[model samples]
Target: MSENDETNLPVDAFEPNRERVKIDAGAFVQQGNTVYRIAQVLDFESIIGIAVETGRSTPLAVAELRPVATDKEPAAAPDLTEIADPDWREAERRFAAIQPLLGRYMVGRIEVAGRAKEIGVDTATLYRWLQRYRATESVVALIPKKRGWRTGQGRIPTFAEGVIDEVIRDFYLTAQRPSAQKAVIEVLRRCQQHGIDAPSPSTIRARLKAIPERERLRGRGYKEKAKNKFLPAAGNFPNADYPLAVVQIDHTPADIILVDDIHRKPIGRPWITLAIDVYSRMVVGYYLSFDAPSETSVAMCVAQAILPKEEWLLLHKVEAQWPVWGIPRMIHVDNGSDFRSDNFKQSCLAYGINLEFRPVKQPRYGGHIERALGSLLKEIHDLPGTTFSSIKDKEGYDPEKHATMTKTEFEEWLVALICKVYHERRHSTIGMSPLRKWEIGIFGNGEVQGVGLPQRPVDRLTVLLDFLPSFRRTIQTFGVTIEGMTYYAEALRPWINAEDKEAPGKKREFVFRRDPRDISAVWFRDPSLNQYFKIPFANQSLPAMSVWEYDQAKEKLRREGAKALNDVQILQAVTELRGKVEEATERTKKARRQAQRRREHEKNISPAAPILPVRSTPPTPSIASLGLLDIDTEDFGDIA
Candidate 1:
């Protein structure tokens, strides 16, 4: 027969033969286990012929043949080394119990029950589980399934779910947070409008409970609610992962009354600027001043915190070690005006310290520092003159009468307390002394690490000048005028009377940084050379006095109606005011507040240049140290 005619023959025509058949028509075919490549084509759809070992032609269906597997098939099994739980082991055990009965019809009910009882399960449950296991081939199927309505099934009509969800979102999660009953009423109202049957109150409650708390808050509640109720608690410093990672700064009025240096009489409370390391609960730095908390106080505290305190400890005759010093990676502070100063922000940025201002009205972010202040104040409460913490605590007690410690004495006592007691004593949060923790962080660990030190100049005067508050002044031909006082430096000679390119139509303005503690000599930076130059007052005869002193002196001049005042007149006013302050038997409340302010201002003046010689030309020193304002400068501007 022709090849085309043979190819059209019916599948049934082919039959096995003992003798050799030509079988010239070849195609891919499978007999029992092996696939044979037929040499010639036959009927392609139904059957193909192959030559076997018996030398007979055989016919097989085309459906039996399959192509060989390629590299796409995985060569090895997957990993299964993970530990299995008891439930999984039980499921595996149950599956093993049924292994023999697989693919076999049950012979008798009694036999099946006996087999299930062996595994502590009923026959009916076993069969159900076995059927599920067979379907999924997973041991997990042997575990009993959770009972009913897990996915909001049968509670509400399928068509009504969307309408009810929308109604609940609109009425339930508002700022007012209406009750579940109100949400149900709204849901029924919407369902009535949409021509759908409303779910029962119980059904509606179930559906509402079905929605996740997070999703409900996100969709319906506003950001404030979401943040307060749904968000996780923020991480604090004590639980910090590393040392110097975070620091917290805060201010509180000390709970004790301080006396003046000369009279030993009571003054108002001194404000304490406290900065504590979060990780170790160590008091990194603190500043005590009668002036209310200001940017200068913050700068003073932070600079002290970042520089080694060996010299300070020695000066105060403190025996214990106070090793804490480093520029913290981040500083957490409240939204006080002092913390928001441009000089504070810029200085922190220049040194790669992150200044984090806590949200307004949120005191939790600074809890560490707040608690430290509380602890320190508790220690102060044990001293001679403490107001205690609250009115209830201070009832019928005479803080003023008991007040014997002057400001200087109180400061000395504080230094001793911080070093000998607070640093050495065990802290509750860390369960160890802060000094011990500091040592462990630096040297106790096996790995190589060292304590961080300040990168900038460590000179007490230089550091003070670096962080002191600054002002804008134009260098006139005579000198640069600030706060009604004219200061001239040799460095100002070249740029006198020039206009600033950055600020149009304005005289050339240079930055003059000054310590509020002493306004006698202000600092001018030669921006080109990046060197600091100390500029002296043009008058040449004024003694070094705090901005507070200068203000009190100028106020006296204003009251005396002196039209043109010189250094001599200012000094006389200051001397007269001091005499009046000293003569008063009992200082008035206003007088006490002013004295406290004066004490704070004077305390901030660097001991480095306590007394500068009177000279008109600016004092020139080796490329080294230099460190705000005029008469009304203290009146109109913030001392910080």
Candidate 2:
């Protein structure tokens, strides 16, 4: 075999094909200069391939392979931020029409006909919308025809349309509350002045009626009426008939205190962000962190919920089957600032997930998730470091003095409880174990057909990138700078100092996604290719650090009267601060916690050692043999 045939070749050899690629038999994988055709998949971990040019046989590890973009695949999802308002509204309307059909086992002709009639569209048109939405799994796919006018579109001239809009905004939408006739008269006069044929009075009325009810009321100076009419009414939870039909996510501080890895002393409670499947009452995903609840926590928890958990479980050395994974049809959440952020909303829309906010002041609307979190916290109350929920409950117990478990240990214990205990034990409301409920919903019982598992995303990293918070920065000659750190890669060469096409004189702002856990690299999405490239720090000598640690270091320098700082000075400060944290780890609770956080970041970025692929659906255990007779269940009263 030639020296180039070795898999140890540098990444530079495959520079031309360095875009996102999928793993599959017959797919061409380019590593350095060698282009190999995947001949066969021996297992999930390895593949046998033949070099295209040399016709030489090669065995490749799946982990070492990188995906390359191909023209045969569908074009990347549209940038929702740039979508026109009218198009966005149309897409939402179409999505609403076909939402019931999504995630169904099968759509029968009768169901399609009924839905079509309800939405006032023909069955054929409804099917087309369903096909498009399912094919891309994106709301953008349902956008109305953009190139030409479709049915019900105005056939009037552009000038006439503009005149109509001006009249509606200026005349119709006013405190005077002018009549439709008056608005039509104003539109006619404007069209005549512009030397264009005026649209009929009926067309003008139709356009006025097209305005949203809330917007119309507000524009007509009926702000109070709009608010009164639009306030969400408290009601029972929406029906979630199947698994992943609806998942509720929320954040709560853990009831137990955690000790640091080094000193085993009590640190403050960590926040837990959890996602629960409403139908089965199964815990889908969770994130444990010292940081307060933010968009980052939501993103992390959602990503974990949607991705396979086998690898993550193995990473923590937890032996259990957590079979829940897939995109939910709808995510029900409270009206928190983090949940309502544009970044989070856009990410959900891109993935075809409907985001429904709970009505204000309605505790019962979120009862399912709240109860699930309560149960988990109740379990935590039994642990040695438990805060015991209330002051009365903890009157004699000293939680801080009794703190024993480290964060990692607590994570493992929580996973065990969720998988082995809660999921396996029978529930009061469902009258069966959550695992069994999920199984029957996904795989189906004798009467009802199951919808089966959701289509696993081909690019797991891209799925995560979509959920991560994004920043827009102009690429400088040296590269893009974010939060005092500079990142650069050869992939950014063509975009250096690029001018914005929309605004010729201004620099272009490119989209970059970063994981707050690790600031060593940021993922940049190329506008032309629509692929993410990992850009590492320009100065490679700087050690890996979390954004929190970075901020702490910067704050320390500010307190020390350092007026100005560069990337190098800030990193030096971080290094010195880390040393002090290590030195004080045994003496102070805060220092020990900080050291633990640093270790977590390091562990997160470290490469995971390979493990055997866990079975997706393990054998269903018998409920009778699980000894549920002594288990107590709480009744939340018909959550579904």
Candidate 3:
């Protein structure tokens, strides 16, 4: 088939492909272990394909075919910065015109006609633009074709162009805004002094026209006006008409103290990272940990949000259903350093998620997540060992003495409260329960069609790996070393001491993904095979340990004035420290908490085994159990 025929295929043909896989007539797709070559795109729902090995025709649904990543596929996302300014602006304009239409599951013919009329375009043209935009989910896909001389490659002499640019920047774009004619005059005068032919006045005028309106206003000393025109309205909340359209995430310290597993004494309050869907006000994902808020907390929460929660719920032994799961279209967060990390930004970009930062000094931008967190804290205040909200509320109460729930037990109680209480209760703002609202959004009401469940990821591990922080290291004869840990696999043999392709004679740094919760193995992607291989620890006999524990061990050695610490010495120290913690678990709160944290980290890394036996209904603490109330009240019938 011709290349044009391949390029014109419907967007559905490319929906299930890898990040940079090209969707075309001859592209390869996989179904389980079978492979097929696309013969033709029959329709939006189905495709005609031929089995590669069997040489037989097969009709396949568009949803069944997954894009096969090969060496020919592009390795990175498109650099949108390469597009000319005019093209980028035009693409943005097109995107703004069609953004309202994108949230709908199905568009009626009348709706399309009305939008086309509003935009001054015909039906066919509008449909074509929509198709292009949907295929890539990027504004650059709508860029108009270049029909004239290439940008930045004009016929003007190099010196003349430089002079023009300098004059525009210094004179034309200053607070003392000069008239276009005067700017042109200045350019011509400069050219004359250099003894060069001056360009026409219209060329300079066109150049001035190309400057963006926002830049022009700021250049002319209208900073306040520019801000008013460009910034989003602070009072109104972000509009999210459908599920997964916008998700808000934030962090807060839990209001209740948790006890250690062995000693049953208070350790400290754990931090909570929460993600809520704006449309339904549902708590889609959360993370609880003793560590402070950081990139790992955000990553773990996002991973939980994207993957289904049935297994996680089961592992926690909570007999409740949590149906929320999907890749959100946009994630809204505050201007914290964790949210602004390069790793988080690149991961979201790779997964086609947009990251929006809260405006400086605008607290209302994140009000949704803040309010939800507040409600959860209120519920926590009712639990044993509660700190309440403030010192005034916590006065006369000793939370550490009353603390009774271990870390695992507290996790179970939190899950129960989220699924059974919070989700079931009606929300004042939404006028319905969160679970009900989520159901209506996903399954649809009578007025609109439901979008159904979001597409499940091809590989859950791959999705998690994408969101994880990465490190780069050069492979040596022994293997790759990271943070005093050495990992090795046969896959690194070919790349050992490989010279950098871009910089001759310099070593090339290969990328590796790791979970800080478990340092037993790291994931390495083989460039030649286009697949990931797990590189285990060089000393496989060493027990798995968290990065935090490793740091603690190293710090202990430093405190002892030990010099020249190596991997073996660090591991030995960790082993000895663990032994001390185990022995002191019965008496010291710190040791008990350390043991609990280690178990929690291990459970996160591998969740196949349940920590506690399955319970049909976990016991709830009562006022009488704390020696507060002994009298029982008779059951009262409903009063009029």
- Best lDDT goes to which candidate? 2
With a 3 Å backbone cut-off (N, CA, C), the pairs that clash in candidate 2 are: 13-32, 14-32, 20-67, 21-67, 21-68
Error of 2 at 120 (Å): 6.7
Residue 449 CA displacement from its true place in model 1, Å? 7.5
Worst 10 residues of 2 by lDDT: 631-640
Q: TM-score for each prediction? A: 0.56, 0.73, 0.68
The C-alpha stretches of model 2 lying farther than 4 A from their native spots are: 1-71, 103-127, 143-236, 446-449, 605-640
Q: Rank the candidates by lDDT, best first.
A: 2, 3, 1
Top candidate when judged by TM-score against the true structure: 2
Ranking under TM-score, best-scoring first? 2, 3, 1
**Per-residue lDDT of candidate 2, residues 184-292 (tens digit):** 8998888888789998776676566556677789989998998667543342245587889889999999999999876788777999999999889989888888878
State the displacement of the C-alpha of residue 464, model 3, in Å, after optimal TM-score superposition. Answer: 1.0
Q: For candidate 1, write residues 314-416 as lDDT tens digits.
A: 6566676676655576788898899998777655643435578876776677778888888889999998889999899899999988998877688778989
lDDT values for all models: 0.60, 0.72, 0.70
